[model samples]
Structure formats: C-alpha cells, structure tokens
Target: MGGTVVRQEILGGVAVLTLSNPPVNALGHGLRAAIDSALEAALANDSVRAVVLAAEGKVFVGGADISEFGTPPRAPLLPDVLDRLDGAGKPVVAAIYGAALGGGLELALACHARVVGPKAKLGLPEVKLGLIPGAGGTQRLPRLVGPESAFAMMLSGEPVDAKKAVAMGLADALETGDLVEAARTHALKLAEGGAPVRVRDRGERLDPATRAGFETKATEAVKKAPGQPNVAALADVVRAGFDLPFEEAVKTERTRFLALVDDPRSKALRYAFFAERETARVPGLSKETPRREIASAAVIGAGTMGGGIALCFANAGIPVTVIETEQEALDRGLARMRATYASSVKRGSLSEAAMEERLGRITGAVGLDNAAQADIVVEAAFEEMGIKETIFSALSRIAKPGAILATNTSYLDIDRIADATDRPGDVLGLHFFSPANVMRLVEVVRAARTAPDALATGNDLARRLGKLPVTVGVCFGFVGNRMLARRSAAGERLLLAGALPHEVDAAVTEFGFRMGPFAMSDLAGLDIGWRTRKATGGKAPVADALCEAGRLGQKTGKGFYLYPEGARTGSRDPEVEALIERTSAEHGITRRSFSPDEIVARLMLPMVNEGARILEEGIAARPGDIDTIWLNGYNWPAWRGGPMHWADSLGLAAVAADLDRFAEESGDETLRPAPLLARLAQEGKRFSDWGGR
Candidate 1:
C-alpha cells in the first residue's frame, strides 16, 4: 500500500511528477493527497516553469480506486486534485499510457493538454457504472470536444485509442517514444507560448448549432437506455452545463454524481461490474492449478450452434474443424459460416481479408473421426442423451489420450455422457448459448468425475474465446437454462391464469428485458420447446397446441404472436388470445386480469426462488455465478444486475414475503421461497453475504 506514491523530479526547469501506483494507478485518497502535495511543491518552486504529470508503469491511471468506494470521504478528493490541475498557474500536461479512464481521463481533461502513448486509451466511462463524470469531465469534455463526441464517449463508456483521441481533440498529440519527455517538452512549449489553453475556456464545440445536438441526444438517451438513469443524468448535466459557468456546472455534475451513487439502478450496475470480475475466479481452486492447453479445436456438428462454436475458435485465432456426418451437411455449415462473416464484411465491421482469414481457420469435414487430432473437441450435436452418449463413445475412442471432450448440451445429464467416455475425467459440459459466437456466457459444467485441469481448461478456453465462463456443478440445464425453465413455467401459468401473451411480454419488456417469454418463443420457434415438453412428458398446453396447429413461429408466420411476412418483431394474434382463454376454461380455471406489475412479479420471482435453490443445492457456488450466467446468457438486463441481485436490491425479506404470497395465491409449491432465501431474508442479509458458504 505504501508503494503507491507520486514521484517528482525537476528536469531543466520542468517539473515531472510521475505517478507510481503499479497495476492500474487508481487515484485513491492517499494517491490524490500525494498528487496534491507534489503539485503544490512543483507550483511553489520558481525554477519549475511547467509540470508534466506522468506515470512510471504502463497505465496512466485506470480510474478512481474502487476499493475506496462506499467509504467515508477523504481529504484531497479526486475532484479537488483535478481542480488544482485545472487552475494550475503553470502549464500541466498529462502523459498517458495504457488507459486513462473515468477519473483518470477526467484528470487528463482537467490538464491543459494531453500527450498520449501510441497504445493509450482515454475516456470518461463513468456512465457505465451508472454515474456521470463527477470530476468536471461532463463540463470540460463537452467544452473541449463537441457535444456529440462527448455524448458518444460518456454515454457509451467506450475508450478511444490515442489516434482517435487526437482526432477528437480529447488528446493534443501522440507520443510513440518517451511519453514523459514528450509530455514535458509539450508542457514547456505551452509555457513558452504563455498561459496554456484550459478545457473549460474552450467553447468552440458549445455553439448554439452544436448544442442543438445535445437535445437530440438527450431525447435518444431515454429511449436507448430506459431503466438506467445515468444516461439521462449525463444528458441533463451536459445540456444544463452548456448554459452555466464552468465551475458551477462542475459543481452541479458532482451533485448529480453523488445522487446517482445511491440510485438503485446505479447500485445494480456497480454490483454487476464487480460480479463480472468475481465470476472469472474459481473458488476452492488454486490459480496455479495446471490447465490443459487448448491449441486446436473441433466441433462434432455443423449446425447453427456447431458452426457458431467453430467461429468462436476461428475468431480467437484458433484453427478449428467443424465436422458433420454427411458431405451436404458439412457444406451447408461452411456456407453458413461464410455468410455470417460475409454479413460482417458487408456491414464494413470486418475487412474482406480478415473475414477470409477467419474463414480459413475453419475447415469442414464429413466425419467424427476428423476431430481426432484436435486438442479439444466439443460435441455440439442434438440435445439427446443417446446422441451425446454415442458421440462421447466415439470421441473416447477417436480422440487422442488426455484430449478435452466437451459436450455443448444446454440441458442434459452430463454425467451420463461422461460415463460413455473411457476417461470420464476428460468430459465436461461447455454450454454455449444460441448464436454462440455472439453471446458472452459459457457454462463450464463440472461433472462429478471431471478432472480439475479439465475444468480449468474449460474456463481457459472460454476466456480465450472472449466468453464469460461460470463453473457450475452438473444439474439439469446447469445455471442459466435451469433458472430460465422456472420463468417459462411461470409464464405458462400466467397464460392459463388469464394473462394475454402480449400483456405478459409488455410487463417484462417494461421491466427492462429485451424480449418477453412469448415473443422469445416465437423467434426461437415454438416447436423447439413443444418438442422438449413432449420428450419430457411435461405440459405447456398453449405452446404445444400452437405447434400442433402448425403455428411453428416466424417460419410458419404464427405462434403465440403473429410475425407477418417474416418480420422479426411479432404482433398480437387474436387466435392465440382466444386459445389462451379456452385453455383457462378447459382447466376449470376462472380467468382473472393480471396487471403489468403482477405479471412481472409472477414471471421474475419464481426464477429468483429457483436461483436460491440452485445456490443451496451447490449447483452454483455463489449467487454471482448464477447472476453472471443470467446476465450474459439469458437476456437478463444488466441494469437489474440479475434475478438474484435484483431480489437483494428489492430487500430479501420483501422478496421472501412476496414469494410466499405468490405461492399461496397460485397454489404452486415451486413459487415458495427456497429455505436458503427464507433464512437470509429472515436474517436481513443479502446474497452477497452468503459468500463461499
């Protein structure tokens, strides 16, 4: 902790204060205090003509130290230190490298000029954490860059590289060589010119015509991000700041930031931010645990999922073979992969050469034997136990000894598949969501006999493919799909209880979900779930009847909703509504109206209850694991954190009470709160408090 300090040196009348906080030089209380003292010393020395703020390590400063979050205010707050830089008598230049994000970027914005390393990334990404830039960034950045550019940076929370930064006027120049010396030279040059330009004084982009764009963006902010208030707050700050004095605007921005710090949406976003980091770590498993190297990959099927899985490997620069049983199937799969890449190329998102290179990494073959040479082979075949067993049996014989055998089963007994393999320890579940290359979540399901290294390899491979891996003990549907199943059942119950599909969907979408269950069913094809229900001898009366009537979804143009002329978004179908009413009466159930709030409660609360059960049963090690899976895979809104986190946010005791009331009202035992949840609620504790226990 003592090692994080600011080092200052006077170089030929130029003072260079280099920040030395290694591993993301976060501007903590101590570091901010040290920076303030160093700046004061540099300013007091008459010999020092200019001050160049630099860092010793690769990163300039990632952001404010999150470890100090929720703690009491300390002297020399980040705003105060940055304010000192803003009003410094001498020229101040920020020598940035790696990242200058959030408060770090705010610091740079406060400086008169910024000199960034070639690889430097700079941005005020505070809106991602559900807060506007507090340290004068909202005012200063808009003044420096145009309102449009500022909106793009702040609202999106994406960092720009040095070259882009220089273009946007975010950074003055780029330094491919000695960053500190270059910054010092830049600072000295500014000093020679007398009174370096401050961002607050720059109003070129704040003209009336340019300021009109702010209103447009302000309107777009509400529509683009509904549940998150930070976007609207940013627009309000910047639009209002356009009229006020710089200092007054900065003060207003700080007030808004502090208010947002306590907003439920902000709290949830912050929780999700930390939860993503925590999910990367495997509890009770040493970081040093040896992992099997996944140098090459192969997928057993050439269908949508298999091709997408192969693309993930190809995108990650790993050569992968996509195998199919027939030549036609293999050819079709390869074409689908090419078409997917071609779409990116057509959209200018991917260059033709890059697409060709990625496509080149993927080879299609007509046999399971083709996967024998790969280091890791994933069976993305149909979700059938017999098919999985057959593939694993073949893979056990064909694959080289110690090769990872992964099953891309959304919901199946992985242990049964592993049993067919000669080396059950090598077998595990690698459940990639639909459109596998696009989705971020991958469930690394650990079978009872799965080796630790095998589990580690699954995690390592998922990371390599740029996916979030949450290790979980094997169960039906693992974490995401299992929780989703609960929601599906609840949704069906609502349908029978007289809630229209559109009404239920409206409630969910209003609650921040991208799509409702019925709409999702239409897009995914109602037949898929209908088939699953048929296989399991389960019941989804309306969904099954829709399939039986050949209303197969968008392909057939009707299901729970109508997708006329192959439209993506579905419209309400009168027939479906009549069918739902008929089903309610057929079950001797009296129809009742369900308000949007009631529908959302019925849809979401059951999932939370099941999540509690998942945690208690040891299927998931922590609430974060389930939340991470849901947040990434199941279309759970990031702003809500996840079902479990949302429950915690709503007050666990309240959630438990609601669950009990719903259970009694619906006469559904599954809606009853899980014992673990009840216990936590009784104790007034959050899921976070459960920890590794």
Candidate 2:
C-alpha cells in the first residue's frame, strides 16, 4: 500500500520507502506529505526494524521544486519533514544516486547513514540562489564534515562526488553494485546493532586552534564574491553550528535563509536563473520544429576568434575543419589551439587525454574546396562585408546541399551577406564574443529570409556547444554590442571631460563591472578601434593620438594606461592624462570634473536608453532577451540582473530624467531618452513590466 508520491515495501523487517515523484523527484507539498505518512507508518509498525530511503528516478532527489519558491508555505514544510527524519527512533539509511542537491542533500544528512552510488553527487548549493540551506543543513553538515569543509562547499555551491563525499565524511560508504540492495544490507546491519548514530550528536571535527580562526579564515575564503551578504550570512550560520546547540543553530539558519530569500540580490539571481532557461525558448518556434544535424563544421579564418570557434565545435564532439588561405596561417591557428588546451591541462582543468581527444577532432585545410564536405561552414574571415560576401559566395557554390552558411560578424549586415548567396534561407549569423570557447553567449542572428529550420538549428547548435543563444534580428551590433556602443561613447566623452581612464574604470568597477570601458579598450588593443575609426573617418582625438604614437595597449605596454614589462595590470599614465587635456583643448570643449556617481549615471543611463531603442526597433524579442545577452555575454553583473532589469529597478521615471539631464547638459541627441523609455516613464511603467515583444 502506498500514497501518491511515495511507496513503502517491507523486506525482512526492513521497510523501504521509495519516493516515486517522476523527473527529479522534487520535494513538493504532495511528496512531503507522502514522506511524512510513510515515515509514520514505518515507525508505528513494530515489525519494521529499519527504514531505507530511496527515490525512483535517475536522481535520488534533485531538490525542492523551484516553482514552489516565493509562494505561500504549504503544510508539513521541508524543515518539519526533515525534523521527523532526524528524530526517528528507527535507523534510516539513504540510498543516493545521481545528484542529491540542496534540500535533497539536507534530507540525506537528516538520515542516520548515507550510502551513495559510485556516480552520486551531493551538495548544498542554495548559495547559488542567494539562499542558505534552511532545513538544518547548516547545523548538521558542519558536524558531519568539519566547519571549514562545509563552509567551502556551501560557499562555492559546487558538488562533491561520492568518493569525495566519503573522504570528507559526508557519506558512510559508496556502493558499486545495485544501490537499493547495498542500502538494504547496510540498514539491516544497523538494525541488529542499535539505533543509528545521529549527525546532530557528532562533535566538531576542527581543532581548537582552527576553530579560533574560523571566522577570519572563512571571511578570507569568500573575499572574491564581495557585496554578497549571503556569503557572509552563510559563514555566520556555519559558525553558529560550532557554538550553538543543534536545534538553536537550525532556527538561526532558517531565519537567515528566509531573510536572504527576500533580499534584492537573491531576487535578481533567481530572475537571472529563470531568464537563462527561458532564452532557449522561442515564442514562434514550435517544439515540433525539425532541426538540422551539425555533424561537421568548417571555419574560414585561422585567427584568434576562428581558432576558438573551431575549439567550440571540436569540444562538442563534432569534427571541425579549419581553413586558412595559407599553410603558415593554418599551422599557427592549430598551434594556438593546442597551446590553449595545454594551458588548461597545466591548470588541472582538463586531462591530457581529453585535450588530445579534442585536438584530434580538429583538422586543417588550406582552401575552400575542403569545406564542401562540411554540413555547416562558419566564415570567421574578417569583419569586412566584402570578405564575408566572397567567402559565403564560394561556400554557396562549393559546399554540400542543405549546408548552413553562417557568418561570424560582430557588426555587419547579415541580410546583405546572405544576398551574395543563392540560398538566403540557409544564411544567418553566429556572432561569438572573443575567445568563443570560453564565453557563454552567442547571438543567433536571423536574417529576414532565414528558414525556420535554420534558425532552430542555430539554437540547437548553441546548446550542444554549451552556450546560451539569444535569437536576434539583423541590426548593427545586435543586442549586446548595440547597447555597448552607447556606453563606449559615454566613457570616451568622460575621458575628455576631466575623468582619467583609471577614474572612469574605478567607478565602473565599484558599480560591480569586472573592468572599466577604458581598461577593456586598453586590453583589447586600441588599434582595432583606431583602424575601424580610420576607415569610417571617425575621430576620438585622444585614442587616435595614442595609437599614432604606437601605444597599442598592453601589446605595446601603453594606451590609456601603462603596463610595466611582463605585467598584465596597467597603471595610470600621467602622459595619457595630459593627452586627454590637450585633446579637450583642441576640440574646443571645456573640461569639467565628474564625480563617481555622476560618471556612473552618465555611462549607465545611455546604455539603458539604447536598450529602450533596441527594444523599440524590434532588434531584440524582449527585455529579458537583452538582459540574457548582457548577463551571459557581456559580464553585466548578475546581481543587478541586466541593464534593462536594473533600469526597471531604478524606476523608468528616474532613468528618463537622468537621460534628459545628460542630453540637455551634453547636447548629444543620443543621450535623449528613447521614445519607449520616455513613454514608459510618463505612463509610470517599467521595462520589466512591458509585455510587448
């Protein structure tokens, strides 16, 4: 006899309670209620000597149903259910397979003993959601594993495999055979002995000297994630486990956990999590839409971006052919690919054998004829439309039928490039950021004539490459780069308006960006922009002058900042500051000091205004799509959500007012509030609240 989500069976006095929730066996209200009744029945039956807990799925229990978050609490909360398991008079053994995460791992910890399959992984990853474990995990984990180990695991939110779990004393043993049989045998032995030992009764494993310095040590461990209160709060909860009684410690953890769940940071992280998953979903695209298989790929160029793109395909277990115009270029590209994997091997991130396997998947060619056999050909040749057109035109003639021709253009017209080929429906853009293998964002640019299957293929390919693809319409710079153009413009203007490169960078860094626009420009080489500006007859006197003097960023040791010999970090150069002042005088513009707040407002408001314009222009599908691009691709700070989400948080009226103020002060029409922004502000609405596509 069984309930809806849990079933019970008796074998030789051992009652096996199997959670039968499909998929991941998420602990929802029904599952919790079923578990409670099952446990009660096992305890009430005098013939039942022990209870073996297991779940019927690939995962023992993934975690709590995330869909239930932020809703009203139901009866028999997770904490209450865990309390029953922890206090059960009969011995309880957990059979963990696949992943036991968050509340699932907490449930296992509440049991008397844990037997894990060889491939099982256990973790308390609540910190990733800006939460700490609420169901006595903080109290019990430290007692099972030492405070330092628990602190590291919870803070990092990474899982430990069965072997690592056993080594850390989190799991009793690992089972190589059938997990259910192993767990039943273990439970039978414990039944004959006595009541199973409870984790709450275990003493702290850390020495007195280590315990004395735990606060400082744990604080230092999480120093990299600054401004995250959950990190500090998690440390406090873990430390409480060492000093406070188990029940009191659990209450304290629950209090902190609930508080963090309500925090803005947590809310933003949760929004980001959902937004990332939503990016895979296309509104008009049907789930029944057929996708073309990308069995083999060919890359046209052999430069940095091309090599990285090749690596993405090769790492995904697809055979890739890299084509360069010359053998020397092909050799150089292959060497760089090997060197990159070699570095990963040295860093212990990739095994030597795995690197060799990926390298073996990538072959080289010297011409376009070699690409005829490829199912997909990515033109990473150059940003020039002429070069892309020539490549695609050749691919159209020589490539296999039904081959998807993709251009890796950053800021070019994909429709125009597609026009060069006969099969416009087969042509699209796969704009990857620098170091394609590492970056998670890919803009799947859909040309006006793109076929539905081709668009679906682009989305599917990104997923296979372990990338987040945001399908966008053809436009300059697409979504992320289009908004970034406005930010770059503001940063450059700030340099002429009395803010030094480092000062602008400092304000941006303080605002939670990894690097300032000027610092990024310096690292990416000022010459690339200089060359583009020269072609377009554009002028940034300070930057052009820096390039003219051969200060091509860290490559030549100087640009907006100076890099000492062999040093990656740059220092502010007084000469660069003088150059900026001279450029201001030459341009007949008055230089004025900008406060950090003013600088941030000026830079960020323009980006938000551009985002509104992009939304109005229909280049991006939704505000969340733009946010997804920036969050995953541009390092827009996940804690802030994205620029659009952040703008909504600031209130559209406030952002509109800032845009108007900047436009009036600077006389730059681009700073004027976008129509959507102005209307939304006037109507008392938010970008997030906007439901339009």
Candidate 3:
C-alpha cells in the first residue's frame, strides 16, 4: 500500500499482490519494483505456499507504459519480473478481470495457472509495433496455447475473450464471481497438493499434433510473405519453440526479439504508434475548445459509402438519419444494411434482436430536409463537385445552425465546398473509405479558415463514430487519396508499357497489399474514376473509354475482369487487353513488355516520391499520418508497416535511383524525383528521421 501495491494475506497458504495503478494499469517502473518486492516477501513467508497476482484497477496490465516508447527503456520488463516469480518454488496464479495485453499476457503466461473473468481479454500485440514479444512471450505462449494459436495472436495482435481464451487453453478456468477470492482459493488448493507445480512442467498437456499443424501454418505464412521479413521471423520464432528445448527456445526468442527492437520496420511502426497518440494533441485544441455533444448523426447519401458511414454511427449507438433523394435509393441502402447485419448474425457475431435494435435506430428518409435538425449532416453525394457544393449549400441552410457540415469528398477541393456555406469555419471534409462504415479510417480535412472548435468537433465526431481520425490539410484528394493518385498514375504508365493490370496489382499485392489496384478498381467499380474524370474535365483515357463501352465493372458484368453472376472477381478479359492495345496505338505509345521488377519500380516510386511531396507540402503532419491513413483506410498490410515504412526499408537513395530509372524509361516527367526525396537520399536518412517537435 505504501508504493502503489496492495498486499494482503489470505487463508493458511495464500498471499496476494495486487497492482494498484489507475486507469488501465500500465505496468511502469514503480509498479514493477513493487511487484518484485511483493513476490520476494511472499516467497520468504513460511505461511505462504502460493500467491495470487491481481490488479486493483479497471484492467490488469494493459501492457508496458506506451509513453516510455522510443525513449531509453526501463529496467526489469514484465518478462523478467514474471520469470523471477516463476523461479520461486511455489505456484503463482494470475487472476485477470480485464484486458491483459502484450507484456500483461506474458506475465499471465509465466504464472503456473490463470483464471479470467467472463469479460477478460488477453493478447500479445507486440507485432503491431513492428516488434516481436521481447519478454519470453514467444517461447512460453507456444508451449501453452499451441503453435497456430500463438502465431495468429502474435501476428494479428487481436485480443481473445475469456471463453475463447479458455477454449484455446490460454486460460485455466473462468472466474465466475469474486476474482480475488477465486484466485486465492485456487492458489490454496494448489499449495495443498491441488494443481500442477509450474507452467514449465506442463508439456504433457500440449499436443504434438498441434505443434505439427503450427509448423505447417508457419510454412504457409512464409510462403505468403515474399519480401517482408517480420511475418517469416514470427513463424521462425514459433518453429524454434516447437523444435528446441524450452530454455533453448527462450534464448532463440530473445535473440530474435532484441534484434528486431531497433529494426527499420519497428522504428517506423513505433514512430507511427506514438504519432497516433500525439495527433489528438494540438496546441490550440486544449480542453477549452467548446465541444458540441452530438447524440445523433445523419448521412445524406445512401449508397455503398453512405450506408457504411451510417452503420459506423449506428454501431457507436448514435441514432443516424440516412437521407436520400429517392425512396428507391433509401430502400436499397436499408437492404444493404440488413444484409451486412445478417452477415454478422451468420458469423455468430450478432443476435437477431441486437441486429434489429441497431437497425431500429436508423431512419430512412427521401428528402434533403428530412434530417434538418441533425447535429451533423454528412454529405456523401456523387463525386461531382457541383453536386457536393449544392448539397453543402442546402445543408448549411437546412441543418441546425451549430450542426457540423461535413463533405465526404475524396479528391475534390474541400475549401471550395466550404465556400458554399456562409459559415465556412463550420464546414470541413470527412473523407471516409469506399464503404465508410466498415473501414476504420476517417480523414478529417481542415480547411484554411475552418474554426478550431469545428476541427475539434470533427475529430470528436470521428472518435464517436468509432474511427481513427487523422488530420490532413485541405488539398485536392486530401492525404490518403492524394498519395493514391500518384500510385494510380504510376500503375497506368506500367499498363501502357505492356504490364497487365493484373501484373501491376499482383506485384503490389504480393508485396503485401490485401488486393492489387485492378482488383480494388473492379470492386469499387471503374465508373467511379470515369465520373471523377468527366466532372474535372480531365482526360481519363482508358477509364473513360471503358465506361463509354459499358464496361462499368462488376455491376456491369465486365471490367478489367469479366464477371459471371455471383462471382466477386472476374476472369481475365482479353477484350480489355485489346482495348489497352488500341489505346496505346491511338496515343502513339510504343508498346513494350514490362517485368514485375519494372512494374514495382514504376508503381511504388511515384507514391514514395509523392509522400515526400505531401510531407513538405504539410498536407500530412508527419510521415506516420500517411502511414496510419493507408494502414486503416487503404488496407495496407500491417506486417509491412506502411508505405513510408516500406520506403525507409528500401533506402531513400535506392528509391531515388529507382525513380530516376523510371523517369528515363517511361519518358514521363511526373516520375521526376521529389526534392525532399533527393535530399533525404543524399543524406542517407529515413522519412522518420525528420521527426516532429
């Protein structure tokens, strides 16, 4: 009690050490030292045959103090402290009531037994920071939970609930009532010849077949990981645990973990992790900025993106008004929402009543003024600038005076739309992903004159909507789409040089994207880009011609791939290839075959170079802002970190050189290297090296 630790005596043979950190109970230096002293004191007491480890907060250990990241690490990490506890001759039972994450889970794993409350969650999420578990987690976890389970937990960094934890053998049992009393009783039973000696001696409970299956899964992961190193390294660490003795495996795990602590990917990922925390910290955005409490939200468009956005607000339990100009469109959005809810129900993730309750909160309307009193009116209208401007003008007049006027304009200038309103400061861009509700990213674009309170409200709104909000300066396309434009242009050139859409998309997807550009384009519908081009009066070339030919993508039954009914992806369309060839000849472009190496260089170099442009232009606050946008919004693979992280791994000099070669080969000046890229390349530095503040 003297130093943030509550120590108590139970019955004959049980003593308790409860960590008393506030909030999430992040295990810090003082807490660790107290835990060490408490363990030692309990070990010395003759009456204490077993100990119950618990926490006196909303959660158990939420993990290491994230605030200490990128600084000199503290002594005695959770793994070391837990090892000391395990070294004691008596049994240690960990009683977990809330989330036990990262180092928290490692500590629980070190205990001889574990009891978790029904609402408890456990996970090893070090990989999310581009790091493997440093504290014997890789070794001890595989021994207890088997290889496949451990591998997935480490790689994906997702938490498992109490039921799932018990089923997976991560938890010994569920603590039904009092966690402390249950833990103390379990400890006493173990002390009086009840449970096993320690986790180290419980190899008999592990199945050899499980190990074999895990090895196979690891092999599959390696096969999936082409150029990436971390996924394969995770698989290797899991393999070491299965092949080597326990102590030897622990040593191997430590070596791999330490080596990756300062790896380029880790540094970038850790930087991104901290930067995300700092995003909510604006100098002017203190507690003083008056925030309007928005109890309900509304979406004016009921298309794919609109329905998803509506779902996001509804999922957060905010009543949403989904307004469309047509009753038919409103009905379609309702049907899509029902299908989405039904899918969740089918996955056993939703109850029928719960789904109905969520749906019940959403009201479908067919008039622009239907949700006139909404706290926030989000217009996800057609990409046409005129349509969006019209919507904004009407929303400003129809919606309540203080209501936030948000435009879901992806690439169009947000400032121009804000000009349509009398109160420009209250208008901003809330660019969500294609299916706004499903994707986790929500880019909050700040126009030059946007009021500080409005910006704060936008950020708060995104949080309330259950999305990650990244601030980006107003520009054509904002941050995420702006970088994507560069990637798209590079890919288009690759197609002109005889690299098929499949080839380019496959190269990037194989490099770690969930889907290649063409596949995504097909899924999003090619007509989207065609419409954007027509509105902007820009030459779409291939996209315009495809749309003119009625090749509007999956809905039209033909796109880059020709689809049959019920098939999400289409087979290769030779007709599209012929179209490409015809366009190339019409433009007087000499066709040449491009290798995958050439394809990658052509596609990625421009995006990397444009990212530098974005950073210098202040469209994105930091390199990590871009990373977070792509990671959440664009489905960039987490294991590869992000584009900027990948750029750091590629080395700035090498990327600049690749851009030079691309410009020379493609004969296009947009491939000309960015000044920032050139400077960073000359200095042999990473984008992360240029830190903020």
lDDT of each: 0.88, 0.88, 0.81
Clash pairs detected, candidate 2: none
Question: Which stretches of model 3 miss by more than 4 angstroms?
Answer: 1-42, 45-60, 64-81, 95-99, 113-121, 134-156, 160-189, 194-196, 208-245, 248-252, 259-272, 275-278, 564-575, 657-670, 691-693
Best by TM-score: 1
Q: Could you give the C-alpha RMSD of every candidate to the true structure, in order shown?
A: 2.2, 2.8, 4.2
Query: Residue-wise lDDT of candidate 1 within 520-573, one digit each (tens)?
Result: 888888888887787788898888888889998888989888887878888888
Native-referenced Cα lDDT, model 2? 0.88
Q: Which ten residues in a row have the lowest lDDT in candidate 2?
A: 204-213
Cα lDDT for residue 305, candidate 3: 84
Ranking by lDDT: 1, 2, 3
For all predicted structures, in order, the TM-scores are 0.95, 0.92, 0.85
Higher-scoring candidate on lDDT, 2 or 3: 2
What TM-score does structure 3 among the candidates reach?
0.85
| lDDT string, candidate 2, 499-571, tens digits | 8888889999998888888888988999888877776577777888999999999989888889999578899
lDDT of candidate 3 vs native?
0.81
Candidate 1, superposed: residue stretches over 4 Å from native: 1-4, 208-221
